[model samples]
Each structure stands twice: as C-alpha cells, then as structure tokens.
Target: MAYTSEENYNPEDYLKDTLNKLDIGFVKVSNDDIILNHNLTFNKIFGYNHEKDLFGTKNLDYWLNSEERNKFREVLFKNGIVKKYITPAKKLDGEMIFLQITFKLNKNSKGEIISSEGIFIDVSERIKTEQKLKESEEKYRVFMETAKLEDLKASLYEKDLLARIFMDNISGFVVLLRPSTREIIAMNNYAKDMGGIPGLTCYSTIGQSENPCPWCLSPKLWKTGEAQHLVVDALDVTWDTYWNPISDNLYLHYGFDVTDQAKREKNLKELNQIKSQLLRRASHELKTPLVSIKGFTDLLLKLKTEEFQSKSLPIVQEIKDGCSRLELLVNDIILASKLESSQIILSKSLENVSELIFSAVKVLKGFSHARKQKILFDLHEEMFTMLDKDRIQEVLTNIISNAIKYTPKNGTIKLKSKTSKGYFVIMIEDNGIGFTSEEEKNIFTQFGKIERYGQGFDVVSEGSGLGLYIAKKILTKHKGAFG
Candidate 1:
C-alpha cells in the first residue's frame, strides 16, 4: 500500500479508493436511470456482493414508492442537483431504510445530461432518534398543558408551534389576551366551542362583564411578571385559573372547572362543624350517667356492714371498675377527636421532666399492682424543660400504661430518662411482648392495633387504639420527637 508523494500520485486511483472506503454509498447511473457503476460501500448498503449485481438495476426502483421517486426527480431535474434530500428507499433484501441523498446531474459539453452521480447516507438510526425525541416532547407538552393551570408557569410565546398545538388540544378554556384591551388573541377548541372568538374583547366573548372581573389577575401579572393564581365563581361553576405573562403586552388566561372540588370542600367543612357540635352534646349526655354510677358505687363501697361486704361488695366493685374504664374510653375518644380536628390547644410552661415521669408512674402504680407487675425507673436528678405539663403527663401515662398492659404477669418494666443533646429523652422497655420491626413504624397510626392473646393472664387489656396516636399528635404539636 506504500505510494509516492502527492505530486507523483494518480487522482483516479485515490478517488476510487477513498470512495470505496467511505461510509457513504456512491453510485453512477446512465441518463436512462439504470445503474452503471457503484462503489463497494454502495453495494454493501444495497445488499449487493459486487458492482455487477446492480449494473442494470433501475436507480428509480430504489425509492420506496413511485410518488417519492417522481417528486425527487422533479426537484433534481429542475435544479440539476438535490442536496441531503431525505426519503425512504428499499434495499436489495426488501427492507426499507431512510436515506439522505445528494444527487447531481453530469452534463456533456453540449449541455445535455449524460449521467447521474450521488451519495447516500443511511439515516435510519437518526430518524428513529428524532421520532423518540418527538414522542417525548409530545408527552411533556401534554403534562404542561393539562396540569392544574395554577401550577403552570411556562411563558409560551405565540410563535412556538408546539405551544400552539398544546393550546389547541386543551380540554378546558384557554385564551391569550391583550392586557389593556382584554382582546382574545388566541383560544383553544374548548373556548371556541363555548362561543369564544379571537380578535374580540373578553368582556364581549367569554366574559359578560362591562369591565374586567374583580378577580382578574392580568393587572398583577403585567406589573410583576409572575404567574397569578385564583379561584373565581361564574356561570354556576367555580374556575381555578392561572394568568401567566407571555410578554408585557400579552398574557395567557387559562382555567378549568373545579365546581365538584369546591362542593366537596364545602360539604366537608359543614360536616366537620356538625361533628363538633354533636361531640359536645354527646360528651355531656354520656358522662352524666357514668358519674352517677360512680358516685353510688363509691357510697356503697364506703359501707363496712357484714351483709353489704359479703354480697353487694364484689358486684359494686365490678360496677365501679367498669365505670372507671368507660370514663377513660370516653375521655380518650373526645381527646382523640379534638386532636384530629385541631380543636385542642396546649398550655406550655417550664416544668421538671423527672417530676412529670414520677407523678405519672405513681398514678398508675395501683394498676400495675393488680397485674402483679413491678415498675423500675432510673431518672435524671433534675431535668427541666419547657412543655405543656398536663399533656406531657398524658403522654407519660399512655406509654407507661401500655407497657404495663402488654407485659406478662410478674414481668418487670424499666423506665429510663436523661438529657440528650438538648432534648429530654425517655425510654420505656418491657419484658413481655415487643412489636415486630414493621409494626413499630405504623404502631402510632390512628386506630392501628395488633391483636393480643392472653398468654398467662386472666384477661387481656386490649385498647381502643387511640392512646399512642393522641400522644404522638400532642408531642408533635409541642415540637417534640416521638417514635
């Protein structure tokens, strides 16, 4: 392959070698449109083993269809050259490929065409990439146009074709308006179908107001160049609208009907109001009877006569315990409901954390004694913190009581408290039954509960599943962390 310098080289040999090695397909055809010669690259591209395989093949037959060939010839003949014209071509194997071809007519001295030469570039892969890009762009456009209008901030100018397509395809009212005159410059199919027309003022077409609607956001958009969002009620329907600025002079006014959403919100508010009122009345009605039962049971327990202690004592004691449990359940229900509705307010003050924990433990000591369980604590000496004293007591009571209830008889419950990185942390560990790893995550969710089996006890103290949930909410409101 060694050759002399450029001055001694042959131009024809160099050209033939270069053409054969190029990635492009090179072909020369007679004026009758029959292929006469082709490079190796051309033969490989057309599924031919040799140039002779295409010697008499009609060049026009390579085109996928007669219409495509006719258009290519019409343009090539009128100009004598066609540069990078893209079209589908059929290969010798009958597979279709997209090609970008540049063809030039070779003319003799008499100015008559004698042959045609061209190069073909396989552009199938490029065409596929372009199609994918187009599809992705279409998806993005759809997302932008159909999303809640208030959330959209793109300043789509009128000259952008894709933006135009997006506007045309919108299922709700969309219009571009001239701010000063309120003239509708562009509108989507939905608006047009509703009697909206371009070149008319919005007040005359879509809007029936003598002046701009009081809630119109165009004025703010003109001054701030920021998207304005609002809800307006018209035509017995509520509209959630976005007014975005395309330029200083023009703005996009887009909106969709939100009547159903508005109605749902309204009904929810009314229902919550009714629930609050009913909760208050029910609390009074329910607690009155329990208080009477508890008062009579206490009076009966105070009597120490032989006959009273023998027969009525146990039944009265059971009634008293039932009343106490019912009262606790009622209080929990009320508190949980209030917490969920944000109806409870906290009263915070500087308090001793150790004192709160000890007080809660002492209050529940009788319950642990009944279960034959012991409570052990290793609390910091004097941990002071800002907290709602009553609420934190409630939190401590709930956690300690839960530990007691779940622990087996004769089980030991340990309570530890200390200051960690500016936070007063408390830990309650029981040697009864612990939750699974997955259950721990959702253990505090509203009404989240696990079925309990009474292993070595006479009765299982299953909860209403609101104690920990309420404690978590109270701690959250106080900016305290809980698990």
Candidate 2:
C-alpha cells in the first residue's frame, strides 16, 4: 500500500489510475480505428463490464451510423483535431444514445499520425430535452395560427385541443354547445362541478330542465347572429353570462358566479333609500323650528320699545341671521334629497331671460354692496325662452351669490347674455379666488366643500356645499348643461 518512488513508479499504471478516476470516458484509438486502451468510465459509458470487454474493438462499430463515423474521422484528420463533435452511438446492448466527443490526433516527431485520444460525454438527455422544447413550440404555433372560430370548427381535433387549453386556464364556468341541436360539446371543470356533461342537452345539464328554458338566448342569437349577455338566476345562483356565437350552429357560453355581488347591490340600494328618507325627515324637522324662530325674531325686531331696541336689538338681529343660515342649510339638504330621488318637476313658462337675470342680481345686490363689489350686466333686450322662471331664477341666484361671496372686496362680476343655436346662454364671470384643478372636480358634488383659508379678504365662504349640486341637477332637468 505504501510505495516509494523507487519501489512502484510506473508511469503507465499512474496514467491509467488517473484516467479511471475521471467521470468522463477516456479512449485511445489507433489510426486503423481499433480502440487501443480505455478507462473504467469508458466501459461504463458503453455498457461494458470491464475495459477488457471493449479492448481492440473497432471504434467505428460503436457509431449508430457508419457514415457519421466516416465524416467525423474525415474532419478530425483534416483539422488535426475535433472538439465537442456530437454524434449518435450505440451501447453494448445496441441502445442508441448521443455522445459529445472531443479528440485530437497524436503525432510522432516525424509528423506522422499515430493515434487519437479523446473524452466522451453522454449528451442524450440534453438532446432529448431540446427535442421536447421544439415540439412544444410547434404545438403553440399551431394553436395560435388556428385560433379563429371558423378554423376551430373546421377541424374537430383542433377544436377539442384548443378548447381544453383555453378553458382549463380560466377561472370561470365555460361550455361549448351545438346551439341548433342543444347538445353540449365540452365543459370546463367549473361547469362540470355544476353537473354539466358533454353529449347531453345544455338545457338538461346546465339549465337542469326537461325542455328548453324560456330565457335561453339561442333563438335570439340565431336570428341576429350576435353575442348576447344576461344576468340570470338559476339553481339558487346568480350568473353573469355571455353566450357568443362561434358559428351558425356552435355557441360558446362563459360566465362567473355573481350571487354575492347581486346581494351586495341589493343591500346598497336599501341603505341609500334609508339614508335619503332620514335626510328628508331631519331637514323638514329643522325647517319647521327655523321658520318659527325667524318669525318670532322678526316680530321682536319690529317692536319700537326703547328698552328692547337699546338692549336686545343687536342680539335679536344676530338670532335672525343665524335663523336665516339654518333655514338655507335645511332647504339645501331637502333639495339635495329630492334631486337624488328624482322627485322634482319643473313648472316651465315663457319668460324674459334678462328679467330673470336681473331679479337674481337684485336679490343679492345688498350683500355685494356691503362687500363693495360691482355687478355689470350686458343683457340682450326682448330675449325670451320657455323655462321654469322660479327654477331658473334659483340657478341664477346660486351662481351670482357664489360670485359675490367668493370674490374679494371691490371685485367686478360680469353677466353676459347671447342667443346661440336656439339656446339662451348666460355667462357669469368674476375675478374671484379660483379653484385649483383638484378642487374643481368636487365642485358640483354634494357636501364637497372647497375649504378656504382666510387671505385678508371680506369673503363669506361658509355654505352647505349643495348650491352648485342642486343648480347642476336643475339645469340637467331643463335639458341644459352646466360647467
């Protein structure tokens, strides 16, 4: 076991030991194609029990194709070496496998060919993997090229293959049917779980009916040759379904269960109705008390008593202002509720558009005067339109008052009227603290108040935030638009 250099220093034995330990097969072949020597790995790679079983065997006999072996030798001799040349070869039992051989010719000092030494690696698995990948690519190419409905119908094998590929990957119930015969052709797992089976009538399997369901869209689909969509309730489930015409006879039906969604929608509707009713009731309750308080405050202000005028007049006036603001808030809430429920009917009449604009300006003149703002009107004379005078005046009041309130002291508000394309257009422009882009989106939304910080201007910014909302709704009812 322990040998010094002088005792066992054989170079041939050292080389064979080194070659046998390598994982790759090592082979030396003579110029006449006979294998001169091979290692243990070579024996294993060629399914031989020992190197003796392969010694002196013709290397060309191992190649599955003799022509390939001839070509490999021709290339090796011409180039004096060949690296990583892949060729099919057979094992001892005649099983074919691919090999990657790297070999080079060994030459004597006179430059004459002597022998060739090479390593062999089994590359059969790699080749098989590449072949499978190529086959998969071809299958995908065919799937994409024949994806049309007409093409799918032309070949039954392609139709079934594509349908299985398409249906298995989606998360919903899907079924293919013959609409004319009412026969089910295929169904996905989801449909199968619901008792769907091919070759059965769709009405019997999916609809679970002895006869065609009255809501079946096949008749309509056949007539129009168009896809139809419906939300149907069946088997205690709600489905949002689409029946698409694949051909004159075939139909592809697909949908998802919407039972929970339908229930949530019903609940939301009920909650909205309750909210509207509560708002209307609370607003009416607040309006009654506000009207009584305003009536009493006015009666107290009218008294000419010296004690009341000197001591209580300012306080009573404050109470009246508070009452007025409360009344406006309550009225806005009531109007918003009505608008949401679509309960408002306009009483329209023929009226002068200029006169209506003037009436709104006159109502807000005192407030603008107190802030030292000017209202300029450029009205067209004899401009008449069939509109609800009271409702239009309300809209004008909301816009003009907002201008007066938001504009700084000593600012100008211009009202211009024109007749264009059968519309009596009124434009209200003011130099006010304009809304930012973000704030403008919420301007006509209920309770979407644009909060303002004091900027050293006499501006009344407090509001119920429903004036624009109600105005927009009224304009919409009048078949007009607001921006």
Name the candidate that leads on TM-score. 2
lDDT agreement of model 2 with the native = 0.77
Could you estimate the TM-score for every candidate?
0.49, 0.56
Cα error, candidate 1, residue 447 (Å)? 4.2
Pairs clashing in candidate 2? none
lDDT of 1 at 18: 52
Off by over 4 Å in 2: 1-150, 169-171, 175-254, 309-311, 378-383, 418-422, 455-458
Q: Write the per-residue lDDT of candidate 1 for residues 269-334, one digit (tens) a residue.
A: 654455554554476668999999999888768765355847767887899999998888778878
- Sequence-dependent TM-score of model 1: 0.49
Candidate 1, clashing residue pairs? none
> 306 in model 2: Cα distance from truth in Å?
1.5
Q: Considering summed lDDT, which 10 consecutive residues are worst modelled in model 1?
A: 151-160
Error of 1 at 52 (Å): 86
